[model samples]
Target: MIREGVMNQAQKLLAGLKIPALQAPMFLISGPEMVINACKSGIVGSFPTPNARTPEILDQWMAEITEQLSSAQNPAPWAVNLIVHPSYPRLEADLQVILKYKPPIVITALGSPKNVVEAIHSYGGVVLADVVNTTYAKKAASAGVDGLVLISAGAGGHTGYLSPFVFVNEVRQWWDGAIVLGGGISTGKNVFAARAMGADAAYLGTRFIPTKEALCVDEYKQMIVEASSDDIVTSDAITGVKANWLRQSLLNAGLDPDNMTAKGKIDFASNGADNKRWKDIWAAGQGVSASESVSDVSSIVNLLAREYVSAASELTQTLKPGNRE
Candidate 1:
């Protein structure tokens, strides 16, 4: 039986949808338009705090989204991402803004603080912390987070390097809360696979970069459409944190993919906050190779939903007793 808290949170998350798929909050790619589109498509949409240049701007964005959605009948719920890292400097201030808006969900990344979780909880907001491994997952769970996003291998921007199979299974063994499996989950079949591996939802990022609502540059979106899994490179040279990136972007920036080295220091001050080192260094997961076209968010969602249903039906048919004959 599902725990009461987990069941309540899951019901809230999956209220307008049949399956669990969240549009992962991409560092620079996710924006108000993208979030709005995702929510309209019956999925949870999110944007990181840093995506807003200032606290006032953040408030404006939130107000606009809230007003627009409220006017629409049966509007889907939305989320905002908070970078809990100490280096962020403005985390406290951003948290205040989040409290004012009180989004239905708040996704915490990089680190988790007891006070932050408490503040969000005080407002009846659910906290979903992103973790790259079992250790972080346990730590986040211990902090009383409502859910955990498992950032497994091949994920874009500050990613983890473990397979979903190993990562999700280990977390499920101890925690019964809402768990979202991240990484190379671009297609609907991948979403089914995540559920099969005991994940409550699939966190998708790279695939949405090609969507029309995303804030990615035209060139970047085209690159994702043209590239394949083999074109992705994982390294810490750009952000001082291990993340998957497009190899073509590296080559275009005059760097050799095979000779890339770690920056040797952890700079949590945003990917290219200072001098724009990561501006040209495009981040992408191994799943980009599967994205063959640029489509609107609705089209992408519809196609994935159809694919998911078809795959599930095929699996059920195969499981029937007479099918074996």
Candidate 2:
């Protein structure tokens, strides 16, 4: 039997899915199409608030998505991502829009605020906060976040340096609300590994860049398809934030991956003040090496489910007969 705490959280999140996997809300890549497809597949889907340029547009998108899903009789829960940084001038305005819709889940990144958590809870919505280390996890927990997403090493944009083993182990030692493990998780075996390490689910971003529902450019998708672990580079030069990127993309953009220097400034307003460079920079995690093709979201999820079942069966076989340890 599943642990009562874990089961309750998983049931709340799964929304009838067999596995606990969420398509991490990519900055610009995650859109309504992607979220819709993931939800249709019975997995949690999400998109960032900034994906919409105005509060009016955000409200329209939420209404359309809610209506479309309800009409289809699909019960999978959807989430909205909020950039809790003060730099986002429209944070409060966007929060107001989110309040009107009350998505089943709200994912807060960059910073977690007590009031934000309180607001979501007031509507019976769950709040999941993304944290890079134990320190941030503790801070989010203190803020009353319902779940902690451990963005461990090998993850895509804005990743952490801790191994999932160390990160999850440390967090589980104290906090026990709900935990999701991220970073280099591209396969079913990885999902099993995360659960074994005490995570309630796997958060995936880079693995979905090549999916048909993603809003990435063709060149970007091709790069992910062709690259491997050795082809990725971690640097803070592009966004003034340390993140993993495809090394070939850096070289293609005429930058030396080996000798790149940090500009020591984060210009969220540079590149036409529209976040254009990030579109070309191409963010991916160490697990891109495991991706073999660019397929649709449904196909990718089907493949992952197949592999997960096969892995579970193999584990059962290993423990049966005289093959047990």
Which candidate number would show the highest TM-score if scored against the true structure? 1
**lDDT (C-alpha) at residue 241 in model 1:** 81
Worst 10 residues of 2 by lDDT: 1-10
lDDT of 1 by residue, 1-325 (tens): 3454546474457535545788889877888888888888877889998788788999998998888778765656789999887788779888989999899999998886556988988889889999988888889988999888999898987789998899887887778888888998988888888877887788899989988888768899999999988999889887778888899999998999898885746655654563255567899998897688888877887777887888788888879697766
Off by over 4 Å in 1: 1-11, 15-18, 270-275, 322-325
Q: Give the backbone clash total of model 2.
A: 0
- What tens digits encode model 2's per-residue C-alpha lDDT throughout 1-325? 1245444553467536656788889987888888888878767889998887788999998998798778755547889999886566777899999999999989898776666988888888888999999989989989988888999999998888998999998998888777888999999888877877888888889888998888878888889989889988998888767789899888887889998796535644342453666766778999997678888877877787888788888888778677665
319: Cα error in model 2, Å = 1.4
Worst 10 residues of 1 by lDDT: 269-278
Error of 2 at 258 (Å): 0.9
